[model samples]
Target: MPESFPAQTSAEAAAEPTVLARIEGVVGRLTLNRPRAINALDLQMTGLLDDALDAWEHDDAVQVVVLDGAGERGLCAGGDVRSLYDRIVAGHPDETAVFFRAEYALNARLAEYPKPIVALADGITMGGGIGLASHAAIRVVTERSKLAMPETRIGFTPDVGGTWLLAHAPGHLGEYLGVTGTTMDAADAVFCGFADHLVPSDRLDALRAALAAGGDPEATVRGFAQAPGASTVEAARAWVDETFSADTLAEVEERLRAHTDPAASRALQTMGQLAPTGMAVTFEAVRRARALPDLRAALAQEYGLVMWFGRTQPDLVEGIRAQLVDKDRDPHWSPASLDDVDPATITGAFSDEPAVPLWD
Candidate 1:
């Protein structure tokens, strides 16, 4: 956990509502309340958020929805992969499947929300955090913001419409970011279309006050928004494009190995540390997502991919155990290298399955 956020016992955290919703005049304020856990989304939080959104969507009294996190550390870190690992280990895959189903539905709903949604994406936001905030109408980030979709590090590809969002980012930046699990700052986020307005961290309270007082979200955000400094990703666009535009993961690795740029070398090092199978899957998924029509299509495909990985790959559990449980950085991925991953296995992972449907 980050030091900036308050800590809580698991029992205490579980007792509290994962999501807190209050009506402040016409603005509906929804806060992810588990600061101790970095407000990580669990199955229960997914349901609570979805239900709140559903009710607020039809309520005439609600003019806008402001989504934020409770702690100073930032918004959500991601989903509760620890719980997912436990359930899978106990031979209860259905539980994890249900979580993904509800979470994806929430993502889709936010993407199509009728009213404006102002997401205060402060601090560390990654994986499922991106799902929640990136889809919002008005994504507000601060200087403290650190955003990413780092599922590849945990033996999973980015889920919750990440493929759609990343695929549409400038150049092949999505490929580089997704595979490498690189974190980007507020400036990089705004440049890549992940965030809209960049507000200073200290001014967030005032911004929230304005929203609670029935101020227009856009105007208020604009009032507080400032330049996001320099965007490192923008500056490295040519390098990112050239290095990540290869036809396959192997080719991408070769290019990175040959490239003289220190950033490319660092990315290659990061990729080397991640689960090889996960990287291969992410590469193919992003490529496929680039050609997909919309969020729904990308999500549908991602649903199948996750289900397959959960059922067939040991890397998911090993990765989670290494990073979260054992605290050992070394994850013994089953297919330890990209060359060891079978193309047929990759094809099978993406194949259609009886996944919990995203939509009725």
Candidate 2:
């Protein structure tokens, strides 16, 4: 169960017309309104959410913030990666840098928020979406939830403080998930510490209403929460810990190939589809992040890696083109295989000229 917040007297609700903000009694409600795109976040939405959080930080009328998506598909799919692709291809690196800077800052703030934040992650929450919900005080998911940090498939390292979360997940499961871009269900999410409660999708509205009416949000969610059954990750815990525990990607691959489990076979198949260099970098990044002191430090390191990827890597562009723009599901990654990726190149991505500092 998540920690509860103190209740406060109801105040007249304030209407925020843009992006669906309304103060319901003492609970401040904010919705990601871009349903057509599964609420994939953009620069404008990130700024709006950051501004609202800043405003509500000290607003007595807003005792707790309830965040959700406007549509049924999910809370959010991710950041507007297509936009970043376009900007990068257009030689507008500054625009891409600005978006990442602001988005990462927002992620850091959520990690440190003083007030309790309740996020309803009922559907496809991946990448940037994880950034929004994973750091909250109360993260609610449903059986319908599908969560992942699948940046490796797009030739990107999992950003938005992903390395921080992945590094701290139990055992070496983080490496398996990060490198393979595995999508976990509700049970897996809770097992991995990515969510707090498992409320049924149908009960989300009632839960939201209870929160808005100044009822204890944590209690309401707990009341509706149900056991998520068994987690596949938990079932394969031993295999994951043993296979991914290898210090090098080569050793991990060797373990996977030698294992006869169906899961190992499936993981090996998935790895074949991802960008090899990206996977190598992701492995090193997560390994390094495990020793970092805090979320801010992890985000800073990710920013540096992403900027470096943009400047030197061709896989990101090729991966996005094949997966998104071309819809072909066939990315011809440069450096073709993990064995072809230079260890020095992977290290350089981590040590690239530092990005503009994320904080003072």
List residue ranges in candidate 2 displaced over 4 A.
1-18
Cα-based TM-score, every candidate:
0.95, 0.93
Q: List the residue pairs that clash in candidate 2.
A: none
Number of the predicted model whose TM-score against the real structure is largest = 1
Please write out the lDDT profile of model 2 over residues 77-185, one tens digit for every residue: 8887777779778876546788888989988888788788999998989999999999888999999999999998888889998889999889988898899989989
Alpha-carbon deviation at 216 in model 1, angstroms: 3.1
Among these predicted structures, which one has the highest lDDT?
A: 1
Model 1, range 1-360, lDDT digits (tens) per residue? 111223347797668788999898788999999988798888888888888888898898999999999988779988888877898898876667788888888888898999999999999999889999999999999999999988888888899888888898899999988898888899999999899999999998888888877867899789999999899998889878988999989889899899989988988899888989999999999999999999989988888888787887899988888788786778898889888989888887877584466566
Worst 10-residue lDDT window, candidate 2:
1-10
